[model samples]
Target: MSPNLLLADESTGSKLRRNLLAVAGTLLLMTTYTVLVITQPTDLTGGLGQGVALATFAAYLLSALLLLAAVLRDLPVSTLTLIPVALGLNILLGQFVGSVMVPLYLDSIGTVLVGFLAGRRAGAATGVLGTLIWSLFAPTVLPFAAGAALIGFLAGTAARFGAVRRVYLAPIAGLVSGVLVGTISAPVAAFVFGGTSGVGTGAVVAAFRSMGDSLLSAVTKQALISDPGDKAIVFLIAAMLVYALPSRMYQSYEFVRRYRVLGNLSGERD
Candidate 1:
């Protein structure tokens, strides 16, 4: 949070119209591509195939966008800006993780960031939106939308429990998030992606499989191995960001009022 987190909405009606128009345009584009896919044969690498892929991608991304539009169109303009930045960060960081083949999927950092700063609905929107946006580049990411949403929702729940306010409790939030996300993601990995996490964490699953463990077990073990500590880092980072926010920004949101990091109201800068 920064003092600049919530810029007042001067032209609320105009902003709403713009948002709706964007949604409409995206839907039209998706429908056009979808119809092309239906009328044309699937080409694994041809133009029509690309159109099919584009249509599917657009549809998936559109769902997330519509959800955000429906639930978060009323958010502060600054927050709307923050969301794009967070989504980009999530994708960039996720790519970095994939390149290194790290066991962790810290991509949900953006989702957690939004939830911590703006509460659950904002957080959920960020998670879903970020994941869908990420999928545009890496279709393999399409299956993990639920896991991303899990991180955002749990991060908000943790904040509500005063985890973000107290430094000591922050790691607890991460640990809890890790456990839940890992459990939730394991099945997705096993079924949707065939236990191949498309990251270095696949090495962990392979090792388990070599030991004669089942695919689901291997994936679950892999998640358990990496998710808890990974999510803990994510939570700690979000808490730190909150701590670094300016007083006005920190205190502006109603959901975070229960936390006492700022001590006294008079202590904040005017």
Candidate 2:
């Protein structure tokens, strides 16, 4: 009957709702990721040697589980973004390019982004944990993964210090991260799979060769290359979707932050 008692009851209900939503969202992500991994096209490809194929499959499964755990733990956004991007890159490269470039998508960019937002210690820890996990199952990805982690840490640290906000700096960060991801992945592939030269020579050479061939063919065909057009279109559609959506979710996030719901709930429990 007291006002304070009524407030307490309402807070308890809010806490329960938040927890339930979080749990439900995590379960959905886990199920979707699991199905995606199982049905991935690469799993059917016969190019990878049997040993490599099996190892890769297991690694992917574990990575999916790890990503799911990260989501459940409410890991930083940068870290969360890494999962879909990594998976997308993997699928794209595997289907269009080749497995030789698999390591390039080891979630370095996302880690770096997270570090930038959260600070060095958290960023570095995320990188280190990601690297260790990738190494355990895909040792061939170690060099690239390590390079990605380091780049992420540096980028994050620099962002924290306000060095990352400059327009020029952002592209530089992306370039450095991409190069590191590509370079590191190449050597690891050579070492773990054998019969390949280090990343410096082989991977770079292959990339250049591929670029040259594509450019020549495109020129010969008189195809005007508008690289940003497709990307712009995609982004426009995404923006429209976000704009069209109701703002309830955004409002809810603001409400929680404004009210410090998590803090309040914990204090109540204590």
lDDT of 1 by residue, 180-214 (tens): 77776665465444566455778889899899987
For model 2, the stretches where C-alpha displacement exceeds 4 angstroms are 1-106, 143-145, 175-270
TM-score, cand. 2: 0.34
- Give per-residue lDDT, candidate 1, residue 58: 52
Each model's C-alpha lDDT?
0.68, 0.39
RMSD of each: 8.8, 15.4
Write model 2 residue lDDT over 30-132, tens digit each, in one string. 4533443344322223555444445534443343333333333444444455444433433343344335653222234445434444444344445545655
